[model samples]
Structures are given as C-alpha cells and as structure tokens.
Target: MSQQAADEKLELLQHTMMNWWVQEHFDYPWRDSSEPDWKRLITEVLLQRTNAAAVKRLYVDFFFKYPTAESLASAPVEEVEQAIHSLGLRWRAQYLPGLASNIADGVPDSSDELMKLPGVGPYVTGAFMVLHRNTSSTFVDANVVRLLGRYLGFEWDGETRRKKWLLDHVDALFSHGYTPSEFGYALLDFSREVCGRAPQCQSCEARTQCAYFATLEANNRALAQDNS
Candidate 1:
C-alpha cells in the first residue's frame, strides 16, 4: 500500500481500538493513575513476566507490606523476595528495592538514565516513563505486540523491523492528542480481550478496520462461496 493509504488505515485502527479500551480495560489496583511513582514502579517490577491474574491476587498485600520506595529500600532482601515469591524472579525483587530507592530520591529525567538501573529494561523503563509522565514515546509490550500482529494480519514471528514499523505507526498516529499511556493501555486491553490470542473476528468492534479480522472474514466468505 502507499504511505498515505497505510496512514489512513492505521488511523482507523486506532479509533476502533480506543473505543473498546474506553469501556473494558482491566481496573487493577496498581493501574490507578493517582498512585505515587514508586508505587507504580513496584507494581511493574512485580508484574514483569508474571501472570496478571496471579498479580491481582497478591498485589494488595504486597503493597500493604512494602508500600513506599523508602519502605522497600530499607526492607530486607529476603522480605522483598517473600512478598513476591509467587511472581518468580526473586533476584528481580531483590534489585527492585534499590531501584525504588533511587526513584524515591529522584526519578530519572531521561530515558537513558532510567535504563541505567538494575531491573530496568527498554520496555519496562519506557513504559514507566510514558505511563507516569505521559510522554509522546509509544510503547509495545507483549500485549501490544500481539494486538499489532493480529491487527496487521501477520503471524508475527517477532521480527525487530516489524516491531519498529508498528511503533513508528503508533508515534505518528498519536503525534497530537492521545497520550502514550492511554494508547498503551488500549493496545494492552484490545490484545487481551478483543484482538486476543485466538481472535474473535465475528464479535469484534474493529472488524471493519482491523487488518486481521477483515482479511479473515473475507477469506471465510470466499471459502463459503467455493463450497456453495
């Protein structure tokens, strides 16, 4: 497709995805926009590579015990490990306290500085920077990647160029109004419920504009005609 055509298609996709997210994004304890920076960081640290359902079960008590960066910073490494024992990566939990402590002291102004921490990676650090500060930078976690894959009608064998292209599209689409946080959460929800691992094309809200769902439906109809 031409560049203009591709841009128009992506805009339509964004609008469709936004509506579903407005209604259905998960309301988790750690998702509160009002929460302090350290608190959010703690949740993200614990959530990394762990299941969301399992995190919901443990988040409250874990937060209650180690509520603040200062609290976790002073907390024993063993105690932090015990708190997030179910999430796995006990080593991550151990380093989390120190990371939180630095945030408590001073949240990093630059993405580069944020990535300098022990537990911070490109995705994790970028996510926190956008979510907390509402930066213009677009994010793509596992969920966003899945959503983009399905939306773009690709099997998505996890290629770097593919990921970059989608991220570039996101940046262009959200160049003005939408915050990166909102777009991130929307993609996260759409990937999980609407677009899904096994996409529900029939009931989906974005079937018209969704690259994957539209192609799938067209294929099904063609198959039916051939059988007829």
Candidate 2:
C-alpha cells in the first residue's frame, strides 16, 4: 500500500481502537493517573515479564507496606523479594531498591535519566513518560509489537532493527488527539483482549483494517468453500 493509504488506514485503526477502549478499558491500579509517580514506576517494573493480574493482586499491599522510595530503599532486600515473590522475579528485590535509591532524590524527567535507573529499559522509559509525565513517546513492548506487526503486515523476526519501524508506525498511529497514556494503555489492552497470539479477529474492532485478520478470514472462507 502507498504511504498515504497506509497512514489513512492506521488513523482509522487508532480511532476504532480508542473508541473501543473508551468503553472497555481494563481497571488496574497502575492505570490510575492519581497514583504517585514512584508507584507508577514501580508498577511498570513489576509488570515487566509479569502478568498484570498478578501485579494487580499485590499492588495495594506492596505499596501499603513500602509507600515511598525511601521506605523501599530502606527495607531489607530479602523482605522486598519475599513481598514480590509471587510475581516470580527474584532479581526485582535487588533491582527495586536500587531503582528506589537512584530516584530517591526525585524521578528524572528526561528519558536518558530514567533509563539510567536500575531495570529501566526502552519500554519502561517510554511507559514512564506516558503514564507519569503524559508525554508523547513511542515505546514498543511485545504486545504492541505483535498488534502493530499484524495490523501493518510487517514481518517481525525478532530483530532489533524492526523496533524502529514499529515505533515509527506506533507514533504515526497516535497522531490523533488521544493522550499518550490512553493510547498506550488502549493498545496494550487491545493486544491482550483481542489481537493476541491467536487473535479473535471476528470480534476485533480493527479487524476490517488488520492484515492478519484479512488473511485469516480469506483462509477460513476458502476452507469452508472446499468443504461445501
């Protein structure tokens, strides 16, 4: 497809996804914008490689015990590890305190400074900017990559170079007036609820524009005709 045509389709997809999200967005502690910046940061880290449901179960209690960076930084690493042991990231106990210590003074506003903190990577940095600062930035995590790759028909072979293309497409999709935090959360929820590894294209709001869904529909129709 031409760049102009692709851009138009992406814009439509974004609109459809955002509209769906307005009605169906998941409720989670991390999505609460009123939460402290440090708490959001910690939640984002906990969410890495861990399911949101698991983190949700522990979020309130975890924060209640270690409510501030100073408290988390001062707590014994073992206790912190035990607190999050259910999340299954053993290293987070150490990493969390280190991250707390790094940001003890204040959470950094710049991406570079945020990345300097322990366990903060490109995705975390991008998430922080969107959730904490409400800034426009493209951060592609696994779910976002899968959704975009299938939607845009980009072949993802797990190459680092593909991230730039994915990020660019994600950035373009958010050109509409949606806030970065809302758009990012919408994409994440959409990926999980509809456009998953085995996508439920029949119920997807963006199925009309999704390349993967088109192919799946075509294949299913062909199979039905053969059986008929």
Q: What is the C-alpha lDDT profile of model 1 across 13-130, one tens digit per residue?
A: 6777687778774887777877877787767767666667788999888878877778888888888888888877788876877887788866776788878877887767767777
Error of 2 at 110 (Å): 1.7
Write candidate 2's Cα lDDT for 1-228 as tens digits.
555666888876788778878998488977776777788888889987677889999998999999888999888999999999999977878889888878777788999989988989887898888766888876666777777778878777566325555556767765768888788788778777777778877777788888988888899999999999
Candidate 1's C-alpha runs over 4 A off are 1-4, 89-91, 159-163, 173-176
The C-alpha lDDT values of all candidates are 0.72, 0.81
Model 1: how far residue 86 lies from native, Å: 2.0
> Which candidate number would show the highest lDDT if scored against the true structure?
2
How well does candidate 2 score on lDDT at residue 190? 79
Provide the clashing-pair count of each candidate structure: 0, 0
